[model samples]
Target: MNAFTRLRYRGSFMMRTLVSRSARLMRYCLLSLLGTLPLAVCAGEPVSPLLSPHQTIGTVNCASSTCHGSITPWEGSNVLQNEYTTWSRLDRHTRTYEVLNNAVSQRIVRNLGYKEPATEVKICLDCHAHNPTPARRGARFTQSEGIGCEGCHGPAADWIGEHAVKGITHSANIERGLYPTNQPIAQAKLCLSCHFGDESRFVTHRIMGAGHPRISFELKTFSALEPAHYRVDADYEQRKGSYDSVRLWAIGQALAARQQLDTLADPKRGHDGLMPELVLFDCYSCHHPMSDKRWTPRLGVGPGRMRLNDSNLLMLRAIVRAAYPDSSSAFDKAVRATHLAVSTGQTEGGAAPLQVVSKLSATIGAFLPRLEQQNFSPALQRKVLVALIDESAETSYADYAGAEQAYMAIVTVSNDLLSHGALKSTPALTDALARLLKTLRHDEQYDANVFRKQLSTLRSTVGVQERS
Candidate 1:
């Protein structure tokens, strides 16, 4: 089946399975333990492995080369003397608070007229704040520092005490206690923990609510944001001292996490609400106009129930119209179709999902011809490239079917970019895209036919239609 059809059928099956599993687990627990055990005992079970905001920020931020400490760098890549200072002063995640405090965020909040719905209602803190754990760190935790190391890697306290020894270095510290980006599952879980939200542990919010979905995390596409510290091999095993480890970890993690989500099937149970907003998928894959409500990041609210803002969809359409002056009618039809698909309430897996793919294909068919006819003008072709990228949007599918679309999107966009003169200006983009394409092309577990066709098409299009 095509990615579109498979997405819908598989998604539906996965949802039912997830709900069944959750129910069965609950029933078994109730019969085996909950029925006999006290409420406190069940509650006492480790609710979440995630550290509290205070413990994470305080511990991670305090051991620094630039802010908390006197001076000097650690491991060459990071400063050991002033970690907090470096984070607070320069890190984008650290600056999320400033953005939240900005006039734009306040205006959105005022527009929503939310009467301070509690810590969970603080939308900005959802992705920014350290996730709180039952083991509170007294008053040491501060919410303003944004996400800390343990936020991504997990609480280091358990491993920290052991690994901090002067002469001891346990690989488990790197492998088990904290997420080693080396482990594909760990890396994906780490990212999805926040981006998609752990339904078992926290609520999930939409991506648009957090501001820019395009800037948000998608398994395959977002790997560019993280530092790959491991080497990826054909075995998909971790190799020490290979930068490629990071890339391997990403592919494995993305696939594994997406597969796990597919196993669950439903977007409602656990943290299904944490799925990225579908419209964000549109923005990422298609670059069409957004007519949804404006996005405003929140604190404490897990990325579980995040939804698209209608107004932003409108704004995006305006931008697309401005970019493709003659294709306004086509763009309008595509956007309308997209809106209708979104309104159809397709879960992570369903027929409504296929409609999205159909719409994207339609848009691409309309614009790609224009690019070819116009001799692939850098400016005009850029729009076509953007549409191609948008065509790869897989919000629901990524959470269910896998990151295949995302990877394809990257590969196609990179080709388009290189064809349109991006390689000369931005060599790194070219290199990164090339490496990713190579990995995708070679990965045995991935469907070779899809990559083969896409890579072939992309190369042929660039070679024949563009000026070298």
Candidate 2:
């Protein structure tokens, strides 16, 4: 099975049976002891861990034997106490900072004319490590730990002491300043801050030009790829509420679109010298070989015109079309207007005018809350899946980025449907998914015709009929 297929956690079945029984007994005992405790009242708005005012105690503080550092999943624990072990032993996040010391990063640093090694550079460290102001660093803090527990969970100084206490609720932990990682909106914002970029730490075209890989992200897929440390069992849902894979994917698309527009609207980040940041445009648009002849009239601009990276926008548009058809036309109009404005402004070889970018940004901003709040029902998920396929086939996935996003969307929605029993998993469906992924495996070799055909095959295999 591909990475898209869910894998069971590594352990023997007999051991798992014993562990489950023990866990149940322990959980019952704990509940009996704490049934009278009041739930924690949520306090202020969520804040990013990096910006939290509290000092960051080191990973060492979080990894003691009695804390989150158990060698295996602790029976009856609300969380996998072995989170520290899993992260250190298996999570790529643990290696993020270390990657800066490798040859590619060294070359990127050199290409950018920086004298400092990538590890020491502020820009590199911003996302690679849990970097904060010196005052926010506790005595135990060390940067070498890369993205540690506090990086995503917020500074541990305030909440670490009582978070695991017998009667403390999850919300109580949040009140004390634990970042709400379980909330989809909050998770999208936090993940995109580094995965896509935010006002503070963005990957500029300059950085990419210097050799950084183009950033690609889809929340649901990436979260699964993270091989999530915690299981979403009944206990987890009782505490954190339900987990909806499709809803996360939708919110991720909307927020990603909004974030891109917001970044483009920023005067400082949007322009580099006399040009709009090249990173804002699809990388493959200008990079592809002249011999490929992949250009199409789908974007409503003339051939050879630079195009904004609209993968997220395209995905979001499909979502709106499926879930809120009344808003679809308006959203489409805004996207077209932005593209036209960008084309017009870029004719002069500079950034799109701020007014133009800001208008579209606000339009997306207007649609955001609704998108976030809209429940992605099984029917809605299926409709969105069909809409995505229909749009991709009609438009022909003109850019590689959009095609990549489409593939992730298809997998995410399909998986959600399968989980809900709306679609059955089969060898044919599995093979179709793998083939679709293969078409996108190499951006340089991507053939739109092949991709469109694979999309059709997937649609048929999953029993979605072609539109009349």
Candidate 3:
């Protein structure tokens, strides 16, 4: 039976008390526990950012062909002026809004009995375009820009002019309304808004059944894969501090874990008709072979009402153990509590799982700031990578989605080690990376044992355990 249909956490009084608490208070308490907020308001709905008055100054303000629209690189300034050109020419995000008009998207919405076209759907626009409330809109806030500057940068009506002023600190710009992409924590919150989803909008189980694509996100990989416009050179670093993909990757997992838990706890996002949102759980459980016998005992602790999609949490635990050994025992305690609450709640039968998840969310929030503070040096990164492998040494990588994430993570860490000159670029490592990627290509036929064996050989070649 679906966990949602089973006993739900019946701590309504406690839940109401939490809801009655100030958003700021809840935010702070969670921050105190985990030390990070994936969104400004971690609980409840979507992020309600503080932004400029009505009238987004507009993307046109920076769209002049000679300014940010230049086809060729402009060398006259420390910041390149061809951002618009790069976005228009190479960025898929620029065309996000148009995607809604596609036949598939239209059909999906139509099947859902939404009379409006996909382009007009609020759920679609929330992510596909830079749709903002009139109070937050400036004169130039155009849906045409499709997740324009203001979408990720906050409404620019208040900040655009001062942003151009020479020597204006990035923090000053942030104060004026620039979303602090320079801050990894802020960036994760911002990116995960669309990359993952929040209470205000999410890709629900119904949508998935309606043919919507499955969402996958990793901050560092996606940032690089974004064919990034901004260069992380000395000038950029001086302004934004150092660039650390490993740190971003680790934090992204933590933030993603928090996002999942938040969704699970939020009733609005957790249910659909009589079923709990199946999309929130491990897709492989239902989507895979009916008689595969792969799921003899779900989660290594017997069956439950729901098998959650805990890929991010798995990585977060391994990372916490690897990167912060001093906190590993404490961290494990918290992680185990969450794991047990979620995995065994319905099997054990209770309406208390969400409450448990809520408390742990706060614990994770407290850990995030400290997690961000640690240096994910190449050496440390190698440790975390190995820890991820060792911790997942069980049949954890058996699920297609989990295995795919593991593949990308392995590729990311291996590349990081290579870039930092920590791991020698040899044929063995190269072949191992290639083979791991190949398994991802054939998820239907993927062999977990082969993937694991290859990963172990990779460990030998990379020498991650020898030192870290």
Candidate 4:
């Protein structure tokens, strides 16, 4: 049997096990978590699911055998009925809450000066689990379940009953509070809230210093890595409309760049006491040993000057230059001005950083709509791939973070090309990609020169000519 068939058989076995063991508890836990809190909207944009006022009905509500808990895909069904099974058995998200009980979490809690366990700490639970206020939690809402179905699908209290009904349309379900995860912009916002953070919950420098891993995200790459529960087949397309992988990557880059600027412009979050938040700067810049000597001028800043982490910004510039060349120079100018302002703010400590952040934010904001509507043709995909490789060859992707993002972008673009038949998979291309992966295998051991050389090999293998 193939992988899908094997998974179906295993899921059948697991379903039997669940039915035999916890059928009673499963029924009880499906109680609704919905309350009277109305969905909040600012201007026209709906509030993020994280900030939504709806009650989060427990995962059990959607895990019944006839609902989304079948052992295999249901005939004539619009969604894969084994969503819960796939998530519980294969997805790492189900184990996020459990991670808090481990030794590393204990050490992190201690380092953060929290006497309570990581499970009990609000900061730790905020991102690790689908934790809402007590008032908003349904009777079956258990934090132990980690990021349950309702976490991403929005609090199910309002729509759970009607969602599975035969006549209820997808749009109608969305109107009742189901989050539009299929939309790239909406997906970016929801994922970035936890990955990069927002006004509500941010992974600050203090948390990183306390042993939390550094945050990194590339939407399309990460989504693929999730091994999505639902297939994008014809049925799914008819219900949710079509999507483009390249557009997902572009929108993700734009939003991530905007979020960074938003953080920098916030009066409360921008700085720590007299110093700017250390987390905003490139970690490798200051963390490297004195003897390493990895420094070279970046953003026109001289040696020994701190540099803001500009991985997303650099990726955004590549996207604009390839797909929207008219805006390339203007966007580059804004980025440079922001860097200079940040550098000057180091000494001046006035309004310079915030001022530049505003300008940069506006520049990126203007592109968001265009990116959402732009169709990334196969030719444009090649242009983007070439731009990413050319920029890496020129800049060497000096920062480890930039190199990491670059690798993800290259894979995303290359995969898109192959899927669309614009590029063929050959042994030379496979070896080139493998070499790039090896170069980026470890952040501490990363060598920019080696990475740059691999980019050149990849460019040549893909038949991208050197830019004159």
Candidate 5:
């Protein structure tokens, strides 16, 4: 029941069984969850199985030689029988548990006052291993496989066999215990749980201080880096609904902003007796010395203001402007109000930060289905690309956070355009993006001057105008 303790995996896991419908199983072979399940599942809406805690049946359950494991791929089949092989060998997630033993995680644990081994600490295990509650853990569950099958996909006890039953719908699978990673909003929330942190596993400033990696996430970028196992083909669209990178990026930014603000608003999340979680505030804003801190005045705010971590907010604005131009100004006002509240440390006023967060959350949530319905074809993609680039123009992206977001945004938009045939395969485009990407490779070492220069070069490659 440890959820990750190493299991003596069956030797038969490599048999070349010519399995039928294995293609669907391969497609289903996704590492898939959420603290905001209630937020995701409305009363009448279909509930995600992950909303309810389910017992983990372990990765070994699906690794039968005849099931997900095989030496090579099954030909002419939809399922790749070597899924387990791929995860265990090629996937870096398999090493999540082992990472805790590293000097860095150990030092973090020491700083966190955990006398026990980092592997056993709840803080470390929550994200590293599939650390489900004991009551929901089956006999097969162990803590050694890291984020094995059920880590993303919900506990499989109820869905294992029933999922294979004929006529069982994808929704039926979700109802049983499969986490619906296919849905854009749902996947955004689920991925953010660890990547951005949720109620159970939040990346607090304390953790960052204790040497956790700076959290940077964008849905399309991260998903591709995972090198997704399944293809987003016609069959995938039929099952998962639809796939849109631009839409995913937009929803992801909105959700991340919402999540960060929600965490900021939570009185319980405040630590070290700080009234508001200073963790919720921007790190570079306070961490840097006075000599290094030159503030930019924007949104009618005066100079010398210590800005909040509003990278996500800025991205969301561009996203909204691209999809619903009319609402962009209103959204901007709300965001500014919230930022002002945080900057001035004023909770009471017409622009109460929490109220602003709620309003924006609802507004962003309302925009999801509308975005989902729209097609992000070549023309739309081009517009979005420009809108996104415009958000980072001139000194607007002077901050490291904004610059980093813009860098990834540029890469994703340009890459997506290339894939969709919206962008011409020209050396100007490729080299510009590559140079911009290199500037972002190291946040600590990033030279803002170099970034600005490269960003200018990147903008010159396109029709994006410099906003005076």
Candidate 6:
């Protein structure tokens, strides 16, 4: 059957009843559950049933009155009365249509002369639709409700019907369809399912060519939607009681996602007729043409164009030093390249406008010979792994302008190390981590206010104690 018809059949009765009664049924069940539980149990406000497995996804399951479908706007809230309409019309998630249908996507397809921009069956539905139990998404199925709730979270069909009935326990929820967002591994699995496709799938042309934000997704920052879809508050005695698991899950997800992206982005393969070096550079990185056509590549992927203006490679070198002090040449070469990039960029007339990129290439060239000369020892490889984690934690890309490309480069290098299993087992890895944390602490502006809130989330998520 065609994709559209498949959706019609699968949607069936579940969609109409589930969506229509969503909010009221959820609140009713939540209130009842809270009433029974002791007051001392501080799980704050009833969780939106969307998080529960008992709620159907992609079946018009959000239409129930007083639930997401409530017609009378909830008190003073401006939330749309019908979540289905709101999600389809107002939510950015639905706008994937504009992205696929846009001129740019068309242009790329024309340039490549492919039959389509996104393969209707293989690439499109990977992230856009849902995956239900007892029925795997066929090779050709493409359900609408693009980027449906279940696309990010796991399938709910198994538990959506069973979770809310009186006496249905959380453990049972876990067994049926529930994916504990609080668990780092589970959260990572759910997210990487789309952002970084599983082993069964290959990165699609659309995902690879989409501009900036569209090209990549971050876990720590992007997962903020949880606050909207779930209960997250600082009012409690311990914030841990609320956001601990979700937050840690996000951090782990970020780390794992990066590793996955790096693994798939084999500069060695050189897909799309580009060199390994070119592949290593994110699409926006070198394509960015500012005044005088100084084509600087994008530091990070995606719409925000966030770049962390720090010596990322230098930091990676530091990680290498901490983990494998013997790899002094590799570490030093990275440091020298970073310093040269900065000094050259600051030259007269903005460092000769675009000559800095050439100088940067020269630095890499100088390092290649040395890098190639020495075989990576097990100890050295371990250091590279430690460096990856340390560098990732040390550097982040948040805002658009003034992002230090050096640190961004370090992020790429670190990701490469992690993907290669550099830190599989070694004492240097532990030392490098401690060193990275110490560096962040000592640096007055390391965890700036803007990042502190986010970092705090990571700390809680990882179950780590606050630094004294």
Top model by lDDT, which number? Answer: 4
Best by TM-score: 4
Model 2 segments more than 4 A misplaced: 1-45, 166-172, 345-353, 464-468
RMSD of 6: 17.9
Against the correct fold, how does model 2 do in TM-score? 0.86
The candidates, ranked best first by TM-score, are: 4, 2, 5, 3, 1, 6
> Candidate 4, which ten residues in sequence have the lowest lDDT sum?
32-41
- Best first by lDDT, ranked: 4, 2, 3, 5, 1, 6
Q: Write the per-residue lDDT of candidate 1 for residues 24-71, one digit (tens) a residue.
A: 432332232100100111111122335323234244445544334544
For each candidate, what is the lDDT?
0.39, 0.76, 0.67, 0.77, 0.66, 0.38
TM-score, one value per model: 0.44, 0.86, 0.83, 0.87, 0.84, 0.44
Evaluate candidate 1 by giving its C-alpha RMSD to the native, one decimal. Answer: 19.1
Model 5: per-residue Cα lDDT over 246-323, one tens digit each: 667777887888888878766677445744566566655655445655666665456676676777877877777776
1-468, model 4: which lDDT tens digit per residue? Answer: 553343344334433432222223222212211111111121245466666788887998888888878888888877889999888887778998999999879988998899999999988888888878888888988889989887788888989988877888767877777877777777888889888888888888887766676678889766765546877655665665566778888989999999998888888988889888888888777765578877766676778888889999889889999999988888887888788888655323455568778878888988887887787888999999989988875464888788878887887777777767677767887789778877765566568889999998998888842232
For model 1, give the 10-residue run with minimal summed lDDT: 33-42
lDDT of 3 by residue, 96-163 (tens): 99899898798889978899999888888888987777666655557877876667767666777777
lDDT per residue (tens digit) for residues 1-468 in model 6: 553333233333322332223223223322321100001221322222223334344534544665466543455443435554455544556555446566655654564455765424344534544533224443332355555554543456676666556788765766665655544344544565555454444354333443212223334223432212432223321322323321232233233423333332444332455423232233333333243232223222223332212332433354345444666565465344433443233343455422543444344334333332333443453344334334335333222111222222223233233334432213443333333333232121223233434333333322232121
The superposed Cα distance between candidate 6 and the true structure at residue 437, in angstroms, equals: 26
Error of 5 at 403 (Å): 1.8
lDDT of 5 at 415: 56
How many times do residue backbones clash in model 1? 69
